[model samples]
Every structure is written in C-alpha cells, then in structure tokens.
Target chain A: MSSFRVVLGFELKEYFRSKGFMITTFLIAIIAVVGLSIPRFIDLGFNRSEEGSSSREFVTDNSRVIIYDRMGYLPPDELLQAYSNFQYAGSEKEVEEAVSEGSADKGFVITGPTSFKSYIYNADMFADEGAQIGRLLSYGKARKYASENNIDFEQFKQTLNPEISSESVILGKDTRGNYWYCYALVIIIFMMIIMYGQMIATSVTSEKSNRSVEVLVTTTNPNSLLFGKVIAGAIASLFQMSVILCAAVLTYRVNREAWGGLLDMFLNIPLRVLGIFLLFGLFGYLFYAFIYGAIGALVSRTEDISRSASGVMMVIMVVYFATLFQLSNPDGIVIKVLSFLPISSYSAMFARVALGTVTLVEVIVSFAVLLISVFLAGFLAAKIYRMGTLRYGNPIKLGVALKTIRRAKKQAKKLAKEQAKEGIETANEDREER
Target chain B: MLLEVKDLVKSFGDTEVLHGISFSAESGTALGLLGRNGAGKTTTIRILMDVFRADSGEITLDGNPFSAGDHWIGYLPEERGLYPKKKVCEQMVYLARLRGIHKTKAMENVDYWLDRLEISEYKNEKLEKLSKGNQQKVQLAATLVANPEIVILDEPFSGLDPVNAQLLKDVLNEMIAEGKIVIFSSHQMPLVEEFCDDIVILNHGDVVVSGRLKDIKKEYGENRLILSSDNYSMPELRKVLESQMSDIVKIDKEKKNFFVLEQKPKVTRERILGRLLNSSVKIEKFGVFEPSLSDIFVAKAGDEYE
Candidate 1:
C-alpha cells in the first residue's frame, strides 16, 4: 500500500476507536429518529378534518367563552363558530366576572361592530380570542344588513368571501418549497467545515506538541501525512452527518402520512440538489481542512491552535452568514458573484441550484474552480507542514511561512538554471576535445 | 553495503548549520557520531534521512545516488515519541506499514520486535501506561519493526538501566553481525566505544576527528605513558618525577591512583619507563596510555563547552 493509504488507515482507526466520536454519532442519529417520529406519537393539529375548509372548530373539552354583545351585532350562533362552547352574557360586567371566576377561559365584550374588550384570568402570548370575536361580529353585521335589504344571506356571504379555484404551476425552481431544505443544507455544510477543520488542526498540533511528528515525517512524506489526515477527518465527519441525516429522512419518509406532509419542505430534498451539495461541500471542506492542517503544523502546542486558526474561522463564519442571508435572493448579484468564488460557492452555489435558476456551464466552471483550489491548498499545506515540523517555540506566522516558500522556490529555480548552464558548457568542452 | 555522505552543506535561512561535513559507514559495522549540543549532528542526520534537503551535498549507497525513500531506514530520533494514546502494537504496525511493509508482515515484525525487547505483554497497552524504560523499549521496537537495512539510533542508551542497556547492546551487536549499517549517536562515550568500530566527532558543524577507533586512539596515545607507584601517593610520585625525569618527560595529569606523563620530543615509552624505574618510588603500574573516547571528545570539543 502507498504511504498515503497507510496514514489514512491509521487516522481512520483512531477516529473509529474514539468513544467520543462513536457516542456523538450514535446519539445524534437517535435524536434524529426520535425528532422525526414525533408526529406519529402526538397530534400536532396539522391534519384538517375536511378539505377546502377555512377554519376548524376548537375541540377542547370544558373550555368556555363568555360574550356580551352590547350593540347586538354578533349572534350567539355566529360566535359559536369561533369557539365550540359560548356563554351569552347580558352585560360586560357578567362577561368579566365569568372569566375572572375561572368559569370561562376567555371573555369578549363587543362594544362596537369592529372593536371589542377582552378579559382572561391569565393571558397567553399566542392567544387570538379577541381577534376571532371581532371577525365574528363583522360577519354577523353583514348578515343583518342582508336580511334588512331582503337579499339572499348565502349570496351576500358568497359575494363577501368568494373562493377561487386556482392551481400554481412553477415553471422554474420553487423557492418557497425548497427554502427549508436549502437552509438546512447550508447550515450542515458550515457546521461540518468548522467541526472537522478544528479536528484536523488539533490532530496536527497534538502530533507536533508530543514530538511524534519527527518519526512521522521520516517514515512518510508530509504530503501523505497531511492529505491522509485531512481526508480521514472529512470522511469521519461525513459519515456522522450521513447517519444523522439519513435517519431523519428515512423516518420522515416512512411517517410522511402521519405527519400530514408538514415537514416535506425541510426533509424531502431533490437528489440533484443533494448531489451538488455533496460535491461542493466536500471540496470546500477539503480546501479549509488543508489550510487548517498547515496552521496546525505552525504551532508547537495544542493551546496555540485556536490563536493560529482564528483567521480561517473568521472566513468560514462570514461565508456561513452570507449564504443564510442570500437564501431568499439566490439569483441576486451578490449571490451570483459568490457562487463562482470557491470560498463561498459551497453554500451559495447549492442555494442557487435549489431555489434559483442556474446553468450547467456555470455549475461546471464553479466546480472546476473549487476543485483546483482544493488541490492548490493541499499542496501549499504540505509544503508548510514539512517546513514547520522540526521547529518548536512560538507559533510561526503564516505570512512568514509563505515568504519562505516563495524564496525557496526562487532559489531552486536559480540553482536549476546554473546547473543547466554548467551542463551545456561541459558538453561543449567534450565536443571540442573530440 | 557502504553509505557515504560527502560535502553536505545545509543552511536555515541566514544561518548555516552544517558546513560541508563528510563521513561514511559500512555494513556490519557501527559508526559513532559524536558531537556536543548544537553541533549539527541531528541536522546532518535529518539531511541523510531526506527530512530536509541539503543546500548542497552528495549522498550515496555503494556507488549510486541514494534516496532515503528507496530504502528502509530505522531512525530512533533523539526526541523520541509515539502516539501516547494508541496501543503499542497498533502504532508499531502503522509505522512499519508507512515504510512499505504489508499488514501481515508488519504485524509479524511488530510481534518479533516487542518479544525481542521483552515488552510483548504490554503490546496491547497504551504507550502512556508503560514505564519510561518500557516506553523507550517500545520506541526501539518501533524503529526496528520494519527490519530496516540501516538503523540510526540517537541516544538509545539514555533512560535505560544497566540491564536494559545491556539488552540494547546485545541487540545492536546482533544487528551489526547481520550486516546492517548502524549509526549510533550518544553522549555516553563508553557505550559508543563499546560497539563502534569507526567514529566522527563534529564540533561547530566541522568534523574535528574522523577515523577508525583503533587508529584515533593510537594516534592520540602515542608517546604518552601511565605510571603509578606503590611506595608513594600520586603527589609524591609527581614530585619524584619532576625531580628525576624532568629532562625526559612532563607530567600531563595527576590522579589519585595514577599519573600520566608526556614524553619529550623524539622520546620513547621505554625511555620514560627506564627513568621511572630508576626513581626511588616503587613502580606499581606502568604502560603506554590508551585514550578513552570521552577523553578524546573533551580534548577536541571541550573549548566550546557551555
């Protein structure tokens, strides 16, 4: 086997043998399974009894509502449409007394046709009982007006609230339908990059701090060690993410009917969009992981990792927030520009593919650019890793390391040119002698 | 097989560490690389192992250019370490596999080295759980698990008890007997002198002394004699020698048991002995002096001692 394979195998074994890794993966998967299966065990009230209905009757037992229609605009039967149990009170004082005495859950006094007074023993932040009573009073006034004019009440109601039958056919991407999953995928990629990037950096720094890097560098090339470590980290994180996501997706698919398709926008993802997400996400992760690995080698202690990798972390954070904010406007100029850049393209391009229009040529070019950046980052990381292996003290600056590599490259070119000139001269001498 | 390094020049940025130093080691023999701290020994070894490219140099195996990747080189670095949280056998096999050994063969090699080093029972234990001496043994096992053709040991005898040191000595002797080129680096001169046939002493990145151990000792020991008298103490012997042999020899060193004398120019050991016998001090021990490796090292590299 090649050295890269050997290193990769060893790193993978380390991750597999870690208890923290195994428990975290298993626990997240369980959480996903349970979270997706919640609708089956409890009624979330997303199911409607009849199709094309505007509202459903409140089904709570022992829940009472007291109403005092001062203007007599709302009928008790019409108020009953908003709540199943309604107590008609002659005075506002009676309505307030019933609510305060805990005999009623809520009380509404219609002081005017469009306005009302509400009373409750305890107010809930999400309660809309007053609004419901106001709507009912308005409808009752419309009915009373129709009766006085000798118009058909049903025809008047139909004229006021007409139902139009329409079907929405999306010719392009459905942003509303695909929004949740795209948001979820963007967060997933961002989290993977941060978590696994730190892991790769920590691994490298620990090896350096413990002095194991000396033996490692001698046993295998730095390129093999770095690339193997990064790839192994990526695979480990990808495995965990796949398990959790698959658990949620499969459980929801099995229970889609039980959920009444409520979570379809978040869980039912298109395979093509998912494919783009995987490809771009993997490349972006590798790009950052290589840089993290190089930063790891620059530090001599594990404590220095955070300080050294802060720059990369900042860039990742910027990309994460930018992609989230651009989800609603995937085809805007900002996202269009970011989609082609390797740093933000992992999420920006995926967002465009899911919710916005994108051409195949644009995707191909963006992917190619990202792939090349990954390779470049890997090569640079390997060089820096090799240079920083034996050095131990304060952490080396990234700028200084880059300068050194550039200078070395220039020196190597000069040396090669000198050697070529010497070879030519030696050949000329030999020819003349012959 | 012969491994030769010639004109190795290495620099780190503005400061040059190794300045065109050269040495050679052959199969079935051990070469001792002696140097004080910061004497560029590790730097040179790293260059030979391809950890760092030399600014300019020629390294060869037999007659062809040498690439460290093409050969299995067991390097026990001075800064010794393995994965502290990993099982001993697991990491040993990993290191061996990195050197191109297959899994089955790697496992076999790890078992063999662990058994040979008497740490077979601890093979499944984490490295951090082992005692320091046992950890050093595991490190040695890691170095030799690939059955490398060349073995480079830096301070291998450190942190070892007499018994463990003897075990390591026996293993090294066996490696040399099997015709493996062993480059032993240590500050413990006695251990190097015990097994090394050749030595190169580096001081400030310069080779101060390089040759066969026998020849270097012979060259340093010439015209020097050790004498001890039973009738008098070293001070008394020194006094007598100053009075009677002042014309023939000069007292170089005075110890509690013996006195070392340097002969005058063109003087012989026999002449010094004749002069010592004629003195009133009774002769107890008299012989031509053979310098120890430590003595030679101090003589050559002592000026820059911190």
Candidate 2:
C-alpha cells in the first residue's frame, strides 16, 4: 500500500511534468478564465448602451408639456424646456431630422383639425421603436373622450387604472445566485469529476495494457493497489480543482461589482451540501474507477482501451441523463432512484443541493446506499480485474468471469479446509514420529 | 530454499490450464519452463509472479510464504510493453521508479544498460521512433532496471533477431551469475538447453516432464547413432544395419549422415558399436547421439500439444 502511494506520486509528477499534461492544464485553465472574463467585457459594452438612462430628458410633446404644467409632475422651468423639444412640424421628414440629428431621442406630434386618431395614426409621426406609435394613436382616442365628455386626464387616471403590486414568496432557504452559481458549480464539479474518474481508468488501462500490473501485482495485494489508485485520483482531481478554483475566485474578486454576491452564496449554502458533494464524489470515484480498472485489466493492447472504456462511458452518459432528469423533476421515480444509487447519486444529489430541494435525512440515506454499493462494486471489480488481467486473445465473457470468481471462492474455501486437515494430520504425524 | 511452487492448480473457467503443477529452483539456478502455445507456460509464470492466482497452491520463498505486499520480484510478462511515446531512458527510469528505485540511481542504471547494449544513442529518443529490435532492448532494460532478486520472464525472446536474442541470453546468464534466482519460459529448446540447467515441460496443462534438462533428455534411453561409408550408400547400409540390429525404430538418410535409432531393450549400443568396429565397411565416421528436448517432449506428450 505504501509502495502504491509512491507509485501514485510518481504518476502525478510524471503527468505534471509532461508537456501534454502541462499543455492541457494550461489550455483548459486559460479557456476557463477567458470564458469568464469575456462575458464581463461584453456586458460592459451593453452597459454603455444603457448609459442613456442618465441622458437629460427633452420633453418632446407640446400638449404633454401643458399637461405636465397642470399636473405638477414637472416644474415651471422644466415645462418651459419641454416646449423647446416638442413642436408641430410641417412634414414628417422634419420630425425625423429633429430626432435623428441628435436633437432628441423621441418626438411628439399633435393633430391639426381632424379627429386625433387620424393625426396620430399618420405615418409621418415619429414614434418610439414600435410601442410608442401605438401609444400615440391610443392617446388620440383618449383625447376625444376627454373633449366630448369634459373629463380631465387626472380623472381618467383615477377612474380607469388601478396600481398592481406583486409579492412572490420563497418557501425554502434561498441561496443567493441559486441558479447561475449552482449551475457553474455543478458544471465544474460534473466535468472535473468525470475527468478524474477517467484519469483513474486510463491510468489503470495503461498499466494493464503495458503488462506493468504483472510486476506490481507480483508483490502487492490488488486491493491495496486499488485503494492507492482511488486515493490518488481523488487527490489529483481535488488538487487540480482547487488550483483552478483559486484562480477563478481571485479573478472574479477583481471584478467584484459584476460578480457581486458570489461569495454570499458560498457563505449561505448549508455546510451539509459540501459534505454531500464529498461523499458523492468519493462513491463516484470508486464506482466509476473500479469498473475502469476492470476494463483496463481485460485489455491487452491500447486499442482495447477504446472499446472497453466506451462500455463504462455509456454508463456515465446514462448517469448524466439521469442527472438532467433529476434537475427537471427531483422527486420523480427515476430521479429518486438515481439520487440514491451510487454513481448517479453524485450527479443527482449535487443538482438537488443546487436547487435547495434535498433533505438532510435523504442525503444521509443516499450516502449510506452509496457506500454499500461502492464496496460491492469494488469487490466485483477486483474479481473481474484479477481475472481480466491474465486473460488475452479473446474478451473474457461475463459468464466466464462470474465462474472464475466462483471458482476462486470455492478454491479458497477448499484450500482452507485442506489446510485445516493437514494441520491436524501433521500434528498427529509429528506425535507418532516423535 | 530460494523458490517453491507446490501443487499449483489453475483453471480458466471450466477448463484446467495448469493442473497441480509443481517445481522448485534453487538460488543461482536458471529453470527453463518449456511448452508450446496454450500449454500454460504463461499461466504458470503469471501464477508465480502473482498476476494470476492458482486454484490450489502455495508459493513460498526462503521457507516462508511470500507476503503479497512486497515489491521485490521482477517479472517480464509474455507481452513486451513500454511507453512507445516516451524516451528510452525516461521509460526505463519510470519503470524503475515503480519498483521503488530512486530516479537518479535508475537513470544511472539506464545509462549503464544502454551503453552495455550499445544502444546509448536511443536513450534520448522515443521508443516508437526506434526500430523493433531497439524497442525490444528497451523492454529488456526495463525488466532488469530495478535489479530484482527473483526474476520471472515469459517468452523473453519473442521478437528479437538472432543477435539481439544472444544479447538477452548473455544478460540472463549474467543475472544468474550474480546469484539471482531465475525462471524463464521459451519454445526455443536449444537456448533453453544452453542457458537453463533444469526444466519443466508442460502439455495440455500437465507437467509431462520436469528435471535437469540433460537428465530429462537422457531418461529417454533409446541411443541414437549416425554413420556413413564411401563404399556404401545410406540405403545399402540400412539393409546391413537392419541385419545387425533388431531394435531399429527409425532410419533416415539425411543430407550429411545416415541416422538410425534403436530401442534399448531389443539391442544394445555395445553390440552395434562392435559390429562397426570389426567391419571392413569403409566407415567415414560413427558416433552416439543424445536425445533433444523436442524429441523428449514428443515422446512424453505424444499428440496432446495443447
């Protein structure tokens, strides 16, 4: 086991020093950083477009200025300034020239002698992007009603419209930035967890393909070596994730205003979710890595890595779909089952935590199930790995693999029995010889 | 007391691959394990190396059952493997590191072996870029880089040219000369006869023959003799030899000699040698022949090659 640790560290160092490893890490990290930063740059440009909110208002409607004066919504000085921007022009081209030549952002038109609808509906009036044109036509209709019935605009406001207010309540503890943050965290965790699990698989595959396991297995128990591999993979993943996270956190903090409340979400989430992620990450590693180890053992060449890894990868893809379904309907049967199952649990449980949907008791129960499943999978995988490592020329069949395990168990039992019998017989023989 | 494999029984699924096989090798002795394909030579090697577990057996070392967590044995499996994408020295050093050797010392050993094999130029070159023979040398170096005390190699001469094979043969000889316990498997019987003193030949998952190679070959006691005379064609001598001996099992007029095999029970070599010594049949040369390992295997295993 200790020797395995040494080998693992050597493996990590080898990858870390490799141009491939360094180059890959560098590329991914740079992409992640640039991906985060590019949005801020684009958002900055968008914010510049919204800077018009600070533009000084030029009241473009002459009638609106008079109404504003009566309503006291504007002061006398402001009302007088509104008359300068709002005016009746002879032709529509003059109105367009006024708006388009940086004189105003909007313009108002007043009807002459006909009904207000005819004047407002004319193509000549400059109405805001689209809705402003409809509002101008509707204003003409309201003005006719005001003139014929002797009703004022203030009375219209009082009798015709009621202010509506909305108050939406959240039932559960709200983690700030729940969706975006949750998604980022989930995606990062998901992608990286897959990567680490595959790392274990590929490493084991390489060893088996190269027949290096023959030398290692000669002196060490397979279990100890596997334990070492599992631990190494987890550590490697965590180490890499932490480095990238640190870089991201540092970068985001530099753009604090845009990413404000980012740390708030981290602080508010229950410490229990962290525990869930770790527990889930662990089982995920074992469940996925052991199966990979088994596949790797069966392969005699690098080409076999592709074929065998796909089988394991299919299971992962299914788990991914299960996670997505869990995200959509967390309490559904499929989602519930996957949440409690070892491999799917990592994905589903993380999603549930992000959604603030899972209970502590549920998490504990799911974890318990996961732990047991991991042990079982590990044991089975070990048997398969042991058998697969020695087999070549043809893929070892499932039936053959099961029988091999059974035969080994039976052989072990028989061997123990014979040892016991020999012990007694040797004792008796020793007495007789003595 | 160096190594012991007692009643090693293994089966692949329902079929037995090695049935209660047993053999031992003392320290400094090279034991040749002989078998054709699918005869469980690789299985036996794997079982001994702990890559495969025996159905029923115990492997002990120096009077104690070997603990499973000790990385002290060096094993070269039947498949020759190294990272083809890696440099020769780098791959060798990495393999050595796996066996608990420090990088610096491993590098030194890598340099030593590369120079010894006269392939030092390939040290900094990727193994894939090298020729097949060079790749084999890299694999050979990986096997001994850790300098293990117990070495088990399976089919170590699979892809080597004759010269490269001799180079590896010399390395194995050197390892044995250093008081190491060596066990190897090969179908090249002559090399086995030259390098390994003792052997165990398996056929159809059973040990058909196991002993000192010379003694095992000697056990098949039908002595062979070859002779030729300028005065007589091989066919003419065959007729006369048939008259001289009743135990003639096989007769062949090969390119260089007239060969004859006689069963020991029916006629003694002393009688034949006397006939040759006294006869005026102008003899070119006559000599007794030793049975080969292949002949011993054929006699013991018969047609059950698998």
Candidate 3:
C-alpha cells in the first residue's frame, strides 16, 4: 500500500477506536431520534379540532366575558350565540369593574358598528378577543340596516359572507416549504466545518507537541501524512453527521402523521437538495481541513491551535452569518454572489438550490470553482506542512511561513534553470570533442 | 554493500547547517556519528532519510543513487515519540506498514521486535501505561518493526538501565551480524567505542575526523606510553623519571599506580626500558597509551559543546 493509504487507515482506526468519538456520535444520534419521535409519544394538541371542539370553544371553555353595548347595535341573543361565556352589564363602568374584580376574564363595550373598547386586568399578548367582538358588532349593524331597508336579512347575510373554495398551483420552487430544511442544512455545515476543522488542527498540533512528528516525517512524506490525516477527519465527521441526520429523517418519516406533518419543512428534505448538501459540505470540509492541518503544523503545541486557527475561524463565522441572513432571500444579489464564492458556496449554493431558482449550469460552475479551490488549498497546506515539520519553539506565524515557502520555491526554480543550462553546455562540449 | 554520502550540504533558509559532510559505511559494520549539540547530526540524518532535501549532495548505495523511498530505513531519532494513547502492537504495525510492509509481515515484525525487546506482554497495552524504560523499549520496537536493511539509532542508549542497555547492544550486534548497515549516534562514548567499527566526528556541520576506530586510536597513540611500577607509587615513579630519565621521557599524567609518559624527540621504547631497568625500579605494566573515544571526541568536537 501507499504511505498515504497506510496513514489514512491508521487515522481512521484511531477514530473508530476512540471512546469519545463513538460515545459522542451515539449520544447525538439518540438525541435526534428521540427529538424527531417526540410527536408519536406525546399529545401536542395539533388534532384538537378533530375532536369536535372549535377553536373558539377551546379558547373560551371556562373564561367569562362581560359585555356592555352603548349603541345597542349588538343584540343579546346574537352575542350569546357567538360567545356562550358572555354576560351582560348595564354600563361600560360595570364591565370594567367586573373585569378588574376578577369576575370576568375580559370585558368589551360596543361604541360603534366596527369599534369596541376592551378591558382586562392583565393583558395577554396573544389575546384576539377584541377583534372577535368587533366582527360580531359589525354583523349586528349590517343585519339591522338590512331589516330597516326592507331587504331580506338572510339574503343580505349570504351576499355579505360568500365562501369560495380554491386550490394552490405552485409554479416554481416552494420557498416557504423548503425554508426550514435549508436553514438547518446551513447551520449543520457551519457547525461541522468549525468543529471538525478545529479537531484536525488539534490533532496535528498534538503530534508536534508530543514530538511524534519526528518519527512520522521520517517514516512517510509530509504530503501523505497531512492528506491522510485531513481526509480521515473529514470521513469520520461526515459519518457521525450522516448517522444523526439519517436517524432524524427516518424517524420523522415514520411518524409524519403523528406530527400532523408540522415538521415536514425540516425533516421531509428532497433527495436532490440533500445530495447537493453532501457534495458541497464534503468538499468544503476537506478544504478547511487542509488549512487547519497546515495551521496545526505551524504551531508546536496543542494550546497554540486556537491562536493559530483564529483567523480561519473568523472567516467561517462570517460566512455562516452571511449565509443565514440571506436564507430568506436566496435569490438576492448577496446570496447569488456568495453562491459562487468558494468559502461561502458550500452553504449558499445549497440554500439557493433549496429555496430559490437556480440552473444546473450555475451549480456546476460553483462546484467547479470550489473543487479547484480545494485542490489549491490542499497543495498549499501540504507545502506548508512540509516546511513546518522540524520547526519547534515558539509558533511560526502563517505570514512568515508563507514567505519562506515562496522564497524557497524561487530558489528551487533558479537552481533547476541553472542545472538545465549546465546540462546543455556539457552536451555541447561533448559534441565538440567528438 | 556500501552506503556513501559525498559532499552532503544542507541549509535552512540562508543558514547552512551541514557544509559538505562526507562519510561512508559498509554492511556488517556500525559507524558512530559523534557531534555536540547543534553540530548538524540530526540534520545529516534527516537528509539521508529524505526528510529534507540537501542544498547540494550525492548519496549512493552500491554505485546507484539512493532514494529513501525505495529502501527500508529504520530511524530512531533523538527526539523520538510514539502515540501515547495507542496500543503498542497496533501503532508499531502502522509505522511498519508506512514503510510498505504488508499487514501480515508488519504484524509479524511487530511481534518479533516486541518479543525480542522483552515487551511482548505489553503489546496490547497503551504506551503511556508502560514504565519509562518499557516505553523506550516499545520505541525501539517501533523503529525495527519494518525489518529495515539500514538502522539509524540516535541516543538509543539513553533512558535505558544497564540490563536494558545490554539487551540493546546484543540486538545491535545481531543486526550487524546479519549484514545490516548500522549508524549509531550517542553522547555515551564508551558505548559507541564498544560497538562501532568506524566513526565520523562532526564539529559545526563539518567532519573533523572520519576513519576506522583502530586506525584513529593508533595514530593518536604514537610516541605515548603507559608505565607503572610495582615498587613505586605514581608520584615516586614521576620523581624517578624526573631525576634519571627527564631527557628521554616526559611525564604526561600521574595516576595512583601508573605514569603516562610522552617519549622525547627521536627516543626509542628500548632506550626507556633499558634505562628503567638500570634504575632498578620494578616495572609492573608498560604499554602504548591509546586514547579513549571520549578523549578523541572531546579533543575534536569539545569547543562547541553546550
């Protein structure tokens, strides 16, 4: 086997054998399973209306409402029909006193055909009682006007409240339906990048600090060591994430009816969207993993990992927030531009595919750019890792390391050219001698 | 087979660490690489292992250019470590496989080395759980797990007790007997003197001395003699020499029962022996003075010692 494969195999075995990795993955998968299966084991009242109780009955079951009408527009019979918990009061002052003294949960006084005053001891942010009472008063006034004008009240009522049946025909992507899943995917990729990236960096720094890198470098080339480590990390993290996601999606599908399909936007993800997410997420992870590995090599101690990786962390954070903010407007210029950029495209392009209209060409172009960037980053990281292998003591700054690599490359090119020149001259001298 | 490193020059950035260092080692013999700290011993070894490219150099084995990737090289660096949290056998196999050993062979080599080093019982144990000496043994096992044709040991005797050190010496002897090329580097001069057939002493990235151990010692021992008398103490012997043989010999070092004498210009050993016999001093031991490897090392590379 090649050295790269050997190193990769060892690293993967390390991950699989690690108790922390196994336990953490199991715990998160269990959490996802239970969280998605919650509706099956518990009653969330989503089907309450199917049990023969209207929303009004459910909301006003035991609450009392005191009413006082100054204009006498609302008849008591009509008001009682609408709200069975209603009680009459002679004056608005009486209604207020009734509410204040806790005799009624709410009180309303009708002042005009479409206006009302509400009284409550403590206001509830979600209360819609005033709007309900206003509608009732408006109906009462309309009935009275029809009766006085000698028109049939029933016909007038039918004319005023006509019911229409309609069905929606979505012509394009259902942004509202796909919004939650895209949002979730964006966050997942962000977290995976940050967490696994740091872990890769820490592993590299650990080897350096513990002085195992000396043996490793001699045993295998730096490129093999670094690429193997990074690819192993990416695979391990992706495995964990896939387990958790598959658990959630499968459990949610099994209990979709129990949840009344309320979480469909999040759990009922389309396969194509998921495929895009995996592609972008994996490549994005490998790109950052290489950078993180290089950063790890720059530092000689594990404690210096965070300090060395802070710049990369900042970039990831910025990309995360930008992608999240543009989730609702996936078709906007910000998201469109971000979708083509390598660093942001992992999340941005997926979001556009999920919630916005995008062409296959756009996706192919974005992915191509990201793939190229990944390879470039990998090569640079391998170079930096090779340069930093024997360096110890204080952490070398990334800028300084890059400068050194550039200078070395220039020198190597010059030496190669000189050698070519020497070869040519030696050949010419041989020809002359012959 | 012979491994020859000719004009090996290496530099990091603008600072050249190895300046045209040259040495050669043959199969079935051990070469001691002696140097003070920062004398570029590790640098030279790294270049040989292809960890770093030389600024300018040529290395060959049996008349062909040597590429480290094509050969199995077991290198135990001075700053050596293994995964503390990993099983000994598992990591050893991993390291062996990195050198292109198949899994079955790697496992066999790991087991063989672990058994040879007397750490077979700890094969499944985490490295950190072992005692320090046992961990060092595991490190040695890791180095030899690939059954490499060439073995480079840096400070291999450090952190080892006398028994363990002897065990390592015996193992090294077996490798040499097997016709493996061995390069031993250490600060413990006596160990190197006991095992190595040839030596290269480096000072400030330069090879100050390179030759066979016997030849170097013979060249250093010229005109120097160790003399001891049964009847006279070292001071008494020195006094006698000062009084009767001052022109013939000069006392170099005075010890409890012996005197190390430097023969004067054009003086013969026969002349000294005849003069001592006439002086009536009972000569107990007399031989040419051979300098210790440590003495030669200190003489050549001591100025830069930290």
Best candidate, TM-score-wise? 1
Model 1 chain A: lowest-lDDT 10 consecutive positions:
A52-61
DockQ of each: 0.66, 0.39, 0.59
- The digit string of per-residue lDDT tens for model 1 on B257-298 reads 998788899888777777667768789988888899988999
lDDT of 3 at B52: 74
RMSD of each predicted structure: 3.3, 7.3, 4.2
The candidate scoring highest on lDDT is 1
Candidate 3 similarity to native, TM-score: 0.87
Return whichever of 1 and 2 wins on lDDT: 1
TM-score of each: 0.91, 0.75, 0.87
Please state the error at residue A233 of candidate 3 in Å: 1.4
lDDT scores of the candidates, listed in order:
0.86, 0.67, 0.86
| Order of candidate numbers by DockQ, starting with the best | 1, 3, 2
TM-score of chain A of 2: 0.68
Best by DockQ: 1
Candidates ranked, most accurate by lDDT first: 1, 3, 2
For A398-417, candidate 1 gives per-residue lDDT tens digits of: 99989878877786676557
Off by over 4 Å in 3: A47-159, A267-272, A328-332, A355-359, A410-434, B11-16, B230-236, B239-244, B254-256, B280-282, B303-306
Report lDDT (Cα) of residue B200, candidate 2: 89
